[model samples]
Target: MTAARLISVNVGQPRDVELNGEIKQTAIFKDPVPGRVKVVDHHVDGDRQADQVNHAGVHKAVYAYAREDLDFWAAELGREIEDGFVGENLTITGYDVSHAVVGERWRVGGVEFEVAQPRIPCWKLGVRAGDKSMTRRFELALRPGAYLRVVAEGEVGAGDTVEVLSRPEHGFTVADASRIFHRDRAEAARLLAVDELAPPLKQWARKRLGLELEEEGG
Candidate 1:
């Protein structure tokens, strides 16, 4: 596969927002930052997640979005959606990491990351898009961006080459996970065997397949 390049490094902090007459904190608003930036096990140096329980963790450390996907949404939405506008910490060009195999390993500058899962859309996503239906539309679009776990903490910058260091043999892609979750419910079983599949997905699969109790019994 052709190499992909990092288009931008974005960061934002959680802030209070009024949505539906209720005050909520969201870190979904991100903007591109120039030059190199530090990356850690939990997040990019200055980035944060509003929901610590679900959105914050080593498994969901860095969120990545494809510039191609961004353009697609821009054309579909009939508006210019800039890089990092979708709350992705890394905006990439060329290869859309959306197609990356589950547990695939990639290197950006000195940072190492493992493709852990897709960025499952939520209410914050809709808020970021300024459209209440964006969360659902994003699911149906099947362009779910990638969430990467930090394997080796370091620094990354715009224009860095994204090197595919290794790929998990399981063959499940980030987009595949999104599709299975939203449209192909039956494929949940296939994900159960993938050790690198996201934890929430694994749990959902076990429950859907009625194997949760069986696994617990083992």
Candidate 2:
């Protein structure tokens, strides 16, 4: 297993939304993008269940750990190979994570979330990406990224070495789901059934799979 090098960490305000109804544009954390993690208090009103706080999808910040770090902990992170997910709030890169099929798990710092599904490209990332196409690029990548539901919630910080305890299921992975979820409605429905996905992703999976929506591949 090759480790992904930590590229850059960044964080920013909604640049559009208000915090707790207060009109604040900046976050408490500087260097918003941590070398390995990014903690923020943002908003996700555009997601499926935007009204719910947990469904906000932008709280608790996002930790963008490098995939390269996985190589070191495969042995020590004693958990089911499929049960690996360090506290990396978001596991991705210019890479794919949506296709990580059902039953596969990622354990990090005692935190675990199965490879549930891909994140729908939302306005939040669009702002973060700085390019309107950033979301488009994520969608095009198909493996938009990995969504994790906190299994054993614990305080995680940057510089943490997240571990990928298990390889993806056969013929299914985060990458595969990305392509299928957006392009093929049938497959999207399938992922929606997985229990590990966050609420927002679950809603997306159900809607896309239920409606069998058609998407024009970019």
lDDT of each: 0.90, 0.41
Quote the RMSD, in angstroms, for model 2: 10.8
For model 1, name the residue pairs that clash. Answer: none
Tens-digit lDDT track of model 1 for 20-128: 9999999999999988999975799988888988887988899999999999999989999999988999999988678989999999999999999988888898888
Candidate achieving the largest lDDT:
1
Report the number of the highest-TM-score candidate.
Answer: 1
Q: How much is the lDDT of residue 160 in candidate 1?
A: 97
The regions of model 2 sitting more than 4 angstroms off are 1-99, 166-171, 192-218
Worst 10 residues of 2 by lDDT: 38-47
